[model samples]
Target: MDNVNQAEFWQQRYETGSIQWDMGQVSPPLKAYIDQLPASAKDQAILVPGAGNAYEVGYLHEQGFTNVTLVDFAPAPIDAFAERYPDFPAAHLICADFFNLSPEQHQFDWVLEQTFFCAINPSRRDEYVEQMAALLKPQGKLVGLLFNVDFGRDEPPFGGTKDEYQQRFEQCFDIEMMEASYNSHPARQGSELFIKLQAK
Candidate 1:
């Protein structure tokens, strides 16, 4: 398998339709999260990293959020997303390595994590936490779903326990909420955790 850290690996998956993690639409729990965001959040900078097909990014644009950014290492999904939302700011559709995204140039008020965590190699989990903390503004939140079950494989969508996540993220964030998601897509119903952590 190609290294998960490289664009070639993800790009090949997108080109070959190997993205089993994509649910074809916004995850239910995340949709609920987005729907409740106050109108004042409309202009806050939001980042969606590893956004395959970017359905959540599309949803945010549809809801009138003006400063949403979507980053994917693969060009295929980024191009597909651009076609899906032609009017979305071209500057915001960044195709870059998430780890390489410089904190000096890119910082968000909040971040929407979907299946991105489990997609990266597990060895980089701490690096993921560090980069996420660096990417957020002070007290900004990192919110979304995580797989609660271990996939027992060496691949993307690699899974882990809530305890591991809590220990990892707590290094840079204050765990505001981490619990079983009551509204995941039927297929993922009992397997996902909806998390909301504010940068420390």
Candidate 2:
């Protein structure tokens, strides 16, 4: 599919209030990771692509993180986020397709992956990996959770096995950690893998 089509796909979901993957709170594993980071790291450039509602971005802003960018092609969620956090830097709230974003225009110390990977077209998985690598600073990390099971559906939230993810990401990242998440939400328990991969 193309950019306009992908944007409309997500826009319709938000317009209809059908965002089930939205946890309504910062993800537990991600929150724990944020809590452990040093205060000085708050200034690190962080990006959260496909950030619907962006609970993590709000949490980061509340925690004093100075530079957190939220990118999503859909306008509905971005508008909602602006109303919710009026003080969040407008420049950081980007409304653009993740694939179209340029490294020269936007580079980050880290990119927090949540449900973004599974939201994309499966045929574009390799391109996703490449774009992720290009957006990060050298040795930058990509951290978050991934579904470890197949949903067997031809739609968003596409799922995959550990072996598939390992092979796919190894092309651009060194897997620092990708294992069963002990702190996953109840619904995702045992079926989610928390990943911490560094640019290769």
Candidate 3:
């Protein structure tokens, strides 16, 4: 966990091609969530933080969501994403630490969480919750998947339980939905929880 919170570690991972957590496609449960969203939701400002490869952002753009932002501290993935999506607004690809994002300058209708949460140091969970709440507009949502199983490791992809997640997030968000993901990718099935929490 020494450099788990640092960009260099992730950048090295991407550079060395050691990203096992990457599914190489948009997450199934998240895709289902996106697909069900009404057309009006297309205009909603969305943020995808710690967006490695940014498959979700690409999917959003392809589906005509204009106001999507992708943030990641690692340059390798962001650079690769830019190459993959040359037409995607350059301003939307933010290569910076998620915790450094200015709440006063950035606000979104919702923030999408994927592997991002698990990649952070466990001690920063509270900060993550507080920052997430701050980055959203009133009544905004924090939606996506969280690991429901603990990996008990000192590295990234660190996992946790539902009870722990509820305790950590409820201080800043109303737990509208936190349940087993029925449509997770095959590799993640039974291990992921699809969550939708509204900012309080």
Candidate 4:
């Protein structure tokens, strides 16, 4: 549980089938968001970090978005995703630590978050915010779901409240929206917040 920063932790979890966070399909809230994206945004650079099983990446590809990138340090899920989407462009599948991604080399129009934020060590939350801001183009959006409730656990899927998120992210982003998601998956209904934050 303490090895959240290590790739082996997640890699071993994937090998042992311990990924409770894996939704097994594209998240419904994200699917709805993707569906409403204008066609002009199709080719915009998109990053999906900690993208285990990468259902969102697959969904994006299926929707004709040509420049989507998936980043996950764990190789097991990345390899499995490659097998699941053989026709997906190999170059876009980056198996690297999200924190190590160079801002000079990679900048995104928008980044999609799923469970990635909660999976990291909470102490690294500020680092996550800094790195996310550095990785995005000016005014770039960060859209995804965040747990609006506390799990009170000492493991992955660490949760927080909306106030904590606002205090953490407002330093680098304009809070466009952060409200309870009406379209969350049944199991997560009422517990998650849909956030759309644009980089300042």
Per-model TM-score, in order, reads: 0.98, 0.97, 0.99, 0.98
RMSD of 2: 1.4
Model 3 TM-score, 2 decimals: 0.99
- Which run of 10 residues does model 1 get worst, by summed lDDT? 1-10
Better-scoring candidate (TM-score), 2 or 3: 3
| lDDT by residue for model 1 (119-199), tens | 898988999999999999999999999999998887777999999999999899999999999999999989999999999
Q: After superposition, how far is residue 81 of candidate 3 from its true place, in Å?
A: 0.7
Q: Which portions of model 3 miss their true places by more than 4 Å?
A: none
**Mind giving the per-residue lDDT tens digits that candidate 2 earns over 1-200?**
33323788889989999999999999999999999999999999999999999999999999999999999999999999999999999999999999999999888999998999988888999999999999999999999999998999877688999999999999999999999999988878898999999999
Local distance difference test, candidate 1 = 0.93
- Residue range 87-160, candidate 3, lDDT tens digits: 99999999999999999999999999999999999999999999999999999999999999989878878899
Clashing pairs in 3: none
Across residues 9-121, which tens digit of lDDT does each residue of candidate 4 receive?
99999999998887888999999999999999999999999999999999999999999999999999899989989999999999999999999999999999999999999
Please identify model 4 stretches exceeding 4 Å from their true place.
none
Q: In terms of lDDT, which candidate is stronger, 2 or 3?
A: 3
The residue ranges of model 2 lying beyond 4 angstroms of the native Cα positions read 1-5
- Supply candidate 4's per-residue lDDT for 45: 98
Q: RMSD of each candidate?
A: 0.9, 1.4, 0.6, 0.7
Ordered list by TM-score, greatest first? 3, 4, 1, 2
Show where candidate 1 strays beyond 4 Å. none
